[model samples]
Target chain A: NAGVTQTPKFRILKIGQSMTLQCTQDMNHNYMYWYRQDPGMGLKLIYYSVGAGITDKGEVPNGYNVSRSTTEDFPLRLELAAPSQTSVYFCASSYEDRGLGGYTFGSGTRLTVV
Target chain B: AQSVTQLDSQVPVFEEAPVELRCNYSSSVSVYLFWYVQYPNQGLQLLLKYLSGSTLVKGINGFEAEFNKSQTSFHLRKPSVHISDTAEYFCAVSDAGGGSYIPTFGRGTSLIVHP
Candidate 1:
C-alpha cells in the first residue's frame, strides 16, 4: 500500500485566497483527520470524518472544511486564508477509533499564507 | 476531554548515550497512548502503542515506552542513541469514553544526537 498521499508539498497563498489540501489513503481506513502543526504548538485538529458523508469539527476548525466522499479520500479546504493559517498540514487515517491503533500520516503540506 | 504534555521540547545527547523523552497525559477515562517519530521533512511513524496489554511496549528503531497509569505518563526511551535517531517525537492519547475518539497530541520533543 502507498499508505497516505498528500499533494503540493509546498504552497504560498495570498490573503483571501482559497485552496484544498488533498489526502488519499489506500488502506481503506474508516477514519481520517486534518491537523495543522505550528511551531511549538504541536498539532491542532481542523476536522475529521468517521466515514464517507460524516464529518465533524475539531479543536481549530475555523477557516477550514472537510469532506469524506469515499473511504479513500479526505480533503481539507481553506477559505479566505489568513496569515494565521500558515503552518504544516498533515493528513492521517486509521482503521477505527484511535484507541485501537495509531494513525498513518502523510508527508504533510507546508502552507504559507501571505 | 483528553490532553497530552511533552515535558521536554528539545533533548541533546551524544551518540551511543542513553536518552529518555518524557510525556504525560490527563483524562478521566481509560486511554490508549502512542509515541511517534518524525524525521526531518517526513511524516510521523508509529514507534509504539499501549492499549490494554502489558504496561511495557516495545517499538521500532530499538525504542520502547512504559505506561504508568498511576502517574499518567508514557515516556519513550532508548538505551543507546545514534545520529540517525535525531528527529522529533510526539505523544498522543485517545479515550473510548468519547464518541469522537479524536486524539490529543503533545508538542513534539526534538532529539538531537551528536557524533
Candidate 2:
C-alpha cells in the first residue's frame, strides 16, 4: 500500500499565483488531514475530511480550501499564494477518531512562494 | 479547547546519554496523547501514542513516553541516544470527548545528538 501520497514534492509559485496540493491515500481511512509546517511552528492543520464528500476547516485554513470527492483523494487549493504560505505541506490519514489508530503521513511537499 | 506545550525548543545531547523531552497539555475532557518524530525534509512519524491502557507506551527506534493525567504531561524518554536520533519531535493532544478528533500540536522540540 502506498499509504498517503502527496504530489509535486517541490514547487515554487509567485505571489498571487494559485496552485493545488494533491493528496491521496490507499488505506481506505475515514479521516484525512492537511497540515503545513514552518520553522519552529511544528504543524498546523489547514483542513480535514472525515470521509468522502465531507470537509471541514482547521486551525490555519485562511488561505486554503479542500474537497473530498472520492475516498482516496483530498486536494488542497490555494486561491492566492503568499510568502507566508511558504512551508512544507503534509497529508495524513487515520482509521478512526481520537487516534485510536495512529496516523500515517506522507513524505511532504515543500512550497516556496516568492 | 485543547493545547500542547513542548517545554523545550531544543535539546542537545551526546550519544549514549539518556535524555528526556518534556511535554504538557491542557484539556477539559479526556485526551489522547501522541509523540511524533520528523526527520529532515520528511513527514512526522508516530513514535508512540497514549489512547488508553498502560500509562507508559514504548515505540519504535527505542523511544518511549509516559502519560501522567494528573500533571497533564506526556514526556518522551530514551535510555541512550544515537546520532541518527537527531530530529524534530512534536507533542500532540486530541480531545476524545470533543466532537472533533483534530489534535493540537506543540511548536516542536529539536533534538540534536552529538557524536
Candidate 3:
C-alpha cells in the first residue's frame, strides 16, 4: 500500500518557470509535511499541514507555498523556480501525537532548476 | 527550535564489524528522538526512536539506540554490519509538548560497509 505519494519523480524547470509538486497520503494521518534536501545536507521543512484547511510555514518556507485542500492532498507551488530551490522534495505523514514520534516518507521528487 | 547534529559525516567499516553513529540534539523542552536510514536514491526509513519509556530501543536489521537524556544524545549502534548496510543515517528531534511537533533532521552520517 502506498502510504505517501509524490508526483513527477523528476522535473527540470527554467529560471522563471513554475510548477506544482503534488503530494497525497492514504494513511489518513492528520499531520502532513513537506521537506527539501539539498546536496550533502539534511531535510529542511518547507511547510506543514495539521489537517485540511490548516497550514503553517516551516524553517525554509520562502519562495514556496502549500495548501491542504483535502485530508489526503497537500500540493506545493512555486511561482518562479530558482537554482536555490533545486533539491529533492519529500512528502511525509504521521499520526498526531502529543510527543511527536515517527513518520512515513514518500519516494521523493527530484527537482532541478536552471 | 529543535535541532539535531550527527557528529560523523561518514563512517567506514569492514563487513561484520561493529559500528556506531553519534547524534546530539538541542531543544528547550522535552523532545522525542528518532533515527532514520536512507539508501541510495530512496526516502528515509525509520530505524528506531526514543519516545519516553525505555532508554534503549531496538530496530530492524539488528540496530539499536540508547537515549541519554542527561547528555542529550541518541546514538545508533550495530553489533555487526553487512555490505548491504551501507547507507545514510539521519537523526531527528521534535518537541514533546503542544506546539506543532515538526521534526528537525541532522545533516546525516553516511555509513560505508566494505567487504
Candidate 2 residues B9-112, lDDT tens each?
99999999999999999865788889999998888888999988999999999999999988999999999999999999999998878456788899999999
Ten-residue segment with the worst summed lDDT in candidate 1 chain B? Answer: B94-103
Off by over 4 Å in 2: none
Q: What is the TM-score of chain A alone in each candidate?
A: 0.97, 0.98, 0.95
DockQ of 2: 0.79
Could you tell me every candidate's TM-score relative to the true structure?
A: 0.97, 0.97, 0.96
lDDT of 3 by residue, B1-115 (tens): 7778899999999999999999999865788888999999888989888888989999999999999888989999999999999999999888888755677899999999999
lDDT score for residue B113 of model 2? 100
DockQ of each: 0.78, 0.79, 0.62
* Residue B83 Cα positional deviation in candidate 2, in Å, after optimal superposition: 1.0
RMSD of each: 1.2, 1.1, 1.4
lDDT of 3 at A41: 85
Candidate 2: count the clashes.
Answer: 0
Q: What is the per-residue lDDT of model 1 for residues A28-60, given as tens digits with 9 covering 90 to 100?
A: 899898999998889899898889999999999
For model 3 chain A, the run of ten residues with the poorest summed lDDT: A94-103
